[model samples]
Target: MPTFTALTTLVGKDSAEKLGEAMERLTPEPTGVGVFEIEDGSGLWEVGGYFTESPDAAGLAVLAAAFDAKPFVVSELPETDWVAKVKRELAPVKAGRFFVYGSHDADKVPVGSEPLLIEAAMAFGTGHHGTTLGCLKALDRIAGEGFHGRSVADIGCGTAVLAMGAARIWPETVLASDIDEVAVEVAEANVSANGLTGQVRCVEAAGFGHPDLAAKAPFDLVFANILKAPLVDLAPEMGANIQAGGFAILSGILNEQADEVVAAYDAAGFDVHTREEIGEWTTLTLCHR
Candidate 1:
């Protein structure tokens, strides 16, 4: 079956959400609709719809004009096996002491390296992306400094790879949380696949909203590989939740935006311990004062 997508961008979140709701009433009716804020410091929200049949161009144009959104760009996506493609394209990634690989490369685990198995189908945080890679390396560096995480949390953990990474070395159980329930499920699945069921706990929450995460406050180490805006917003809470002299491994920041994130954390009483750039992404290791 062929799939089609119609995408447009608008200035405000309200308008984007309205446009997404309107798309659900279209003739062919979108199979799914999504509204997301573009996180590049641009005050833009993107509205997109997916359909099994071709969308009605006229209806899309009318909605775009009504919402003051840019014209919808409709495109037909080729039917490709995305999982197979990921398996072929995503090779094993080695970050310091951690070696992340899929089952297909299970035989390639190196001696003396922490092995973290993340299937390609699970997608996020397979240790291939610069942000995740950088975080793993940062964790390795902290461990090398003789810092052991007694209590840890992986906020916005995608596949719980970072949590698993922490669990691999430390005896403490790591808590992994995500706002999306699906991501929590994926994280749990990955934890089991890595033989880390009891070592890593998965929960659904934004930031530290969940009870498990709240009760386990003042963590010794925290990993948040989310974007700049959220990272900035999370600083104050991060300050309160992390123990004095604890560590925070933060990523999902562009190289250009690293300064802003550092400034935010600095205000929260965190000193920049180390900053690393891999490709266009920057990872920060901070110490709570």
Candidate 2:
């Protein structure tokens, strides 16, 4: 079936969320509505809705005018198999010893390389993105230096790819957590797919808030591939959770934002061990002092 969408942009988060709630009450009501901040430093938030039937343009216009938002743009989206498209576009990624690929590329697993199967899904971190790729490489580098992670935690774990990567090399159970429940479910599925059901534990938590994670504190290594704001905010917590002389691999930072993140971690008693830049992203490996 063809899908239709109505999208509008507004100035503030509050207004955008209110507009999204209003869209839910429209005739032939939207199947789903979402409000997201546009991260271009524009202070703009995007409100959008998807529908199986054509959206009511008049209703959207009325809501836009009432909320002082831009005029809604309605469009009919062609029916397409998104999974097949993603499988076609996302080739396998190789970062040091780790190889990340979907089931379609199962035949391409190179011998002697640590294989990590991550099927395309609603969750993130397939290792194709620079942030994930860089983290994988940093993990490999740390292992190459003869560091064995007795306890590892992957904060904001998406598909649990990094957690699986750590599990592949070490015998200890790796903890993977994400704030989104759906992501935790997806991480569990990925862990099972990689035959890591017992090796990686998945949890739903923000940062280190979960009881299970708190019980497993002072990790020898931690992975937090989240944005700069949360990474900075979690600096003190990260320092507390990581053992002295342990490591933290952090990414999801723009190239220009690396220095600021480094400063935050530095103040939290971390010293930069290594830094890698991939495209527009930068990943840092920090040693807890």
Candidate 3:
């Protein structure tokens, strides 16, 4: 089956969302509509729709004009076996004490490093990305500084690689949560694949909203490898959920956005302990004050 996508960008979230709603009502209705901020400090929001068949170009044109957005660029996506393609393209990544590899690369695990199996499919957070890599490095640094987590949580834990990394070193049961249900399922599968079924608990939650996460509050450490806006929105709750003198390892931020994120967390009662830039992303370790 062929798949088609129509993409456009607008200035405001309200316009993007309204355009998404309008896309849903088009003939040959979109299978899915997604609206998201561009996140590059562009101040633009993107509205994209996926369709099983070719979309109505005229309808898209009208919506774009109505929303004051860029003209929709429609494209047909090739049907490719993404899993095999990813396996062929993504080499195993080494970040600090962690060696993250796909099952296909099992033979490459280094002797003394912590190994985490993350098959590249359906979810995010392979340690190859700078954000994930930086978080792993931060965790390693914290461990080297003689801190061990009593209880930890990874918010927006896509594949639970970070949680698994923490579990590999510490005695704590790491709770991994994500807003997407499919991501939770992926995390669970990765946990099992890593033989970490009892060590990492997976839940579907936005931030710390899940009761299981809330009950495990005042965590000794927390990892949130999600983007800027959510991290900022999560600051107050992060302050409340982390124990006094506990730590937070945060990533998924562009280097340019790190200062704003730091200010937000500082207002929420955290003091930046360390800052590391990997490629274009910045990872921060902060202590709750």
Top candidate (TM-score): 1
Local distance difference test values of all predictions, in order: 0.95, 0.93, 0.93
Ranking by TM-score: 1, 3, 2
Q: In model 2, what lDDT does residue 196 have?
A: 95
TM-scores for all candidates: the values are: 0.98, 0.94, 0.95
Better of 1 and 2 by lDDT: 1
Tens digits of per-residue lDDT, candidate 3, 119-171, equal 87832588878999999999999999999898999999988899999999998
Per-model RMSD to reference: 1.0, 1.7, 1.5
Error of 1 at 122 (Å): 2.0
lDDT of 2 by residue, 1-289 (tens): 9899999899998999999999999999899999987755688999999999998878888999999999999999988888888898889999999999999999999999999999865425888899999999999999999999999999999888899999999999999999999889999999998999988999999999999999989899999998887899999999999999999999999998899999999999999999999999999999999
**Tens-place lDDT digits, model 1, residues 160-233:** 99999999999899999999999999999999998999999999999999999989998999999999999999
Error of 2 at 213 (Å): 0.6
Alpha-carbon shift of residue 27 in model 2 (angstroms)? 1.8
